[model samples]
Target: MEIYVTIKGKVEPDKMAEFNGLFDLMVAGKTGAALETYGEDTFPAAESTLEKVLDKFEAAYDSINLESYTLEQGKLTLNFMGSYALEQILPDLQVWLLACGVKDVELEGNWV
Candidate 1:
């Protein structure tokens, strides 16, 4: 099945630098300090942690495919084909996003 997982959220302007720091680092293809090692609560391990987390999910769930990933200030959308349910993905994502300074995290999905 193909699924669209849409995440709606906000990150306070003051926190934008925190979120952007990680995003920008990843977008620039750089490595950052691990979340556990970093003093800041925000997850800076963008390249490693994010993909590692997703890899863990993919390993546990067969037939999981990631099609698209999109992120912006107020919205995030992930498209994929998967046998696993949204429950398997959303909670961890919610936690990580919040730690990354994303507020009001919400998830919705459609399958086809």
Candidate 2:
């Protein structure tokens, strides 16, 4: 089966690279370093890591107003139209997002 996933968001032009790097570090289990580099004030290590990431993104990039994920079949496609930073990091970001909520995952066309 093929699945498509899409994500959308916005990021500050200056902090775009930081945002992408943070996401990559988080996914690689380098949360400690990420927190240190980005400062723990915004992205504190705690429950709901996804929420933390989102919160940090929002703070860093006030322009980020939309973040969405869509899945269809086995092909995972991420669309971060609003966020240029996210667009660059889509490949890794998708994998991390899926890991966040694996149980609630649903196949495309599968009705809840």
**TM-score winner:** 1
Residues 36-70 of candidate 2 have per-residue lDDT tens digits of 55544443332254545455555556222223333
Q: Which ranges of candidate 1 are over 4 A from the true structure?
A: 17-52, 61-87
CA lDDT for candidate 2:
0.40
Local accuracy by lDDT, each model: 0.54, 0.40
Give one digit per residue, the lDDT tens place, for model 1 in 1-112. 5456666677666665665554454434343344333314465544344555556565676423445445666454444445455447667656667666677777766755
Clashing pairs in 1: none
Query: Going through the candidates in order, what is the number of backbone clashes in each?
Result: 0, 15
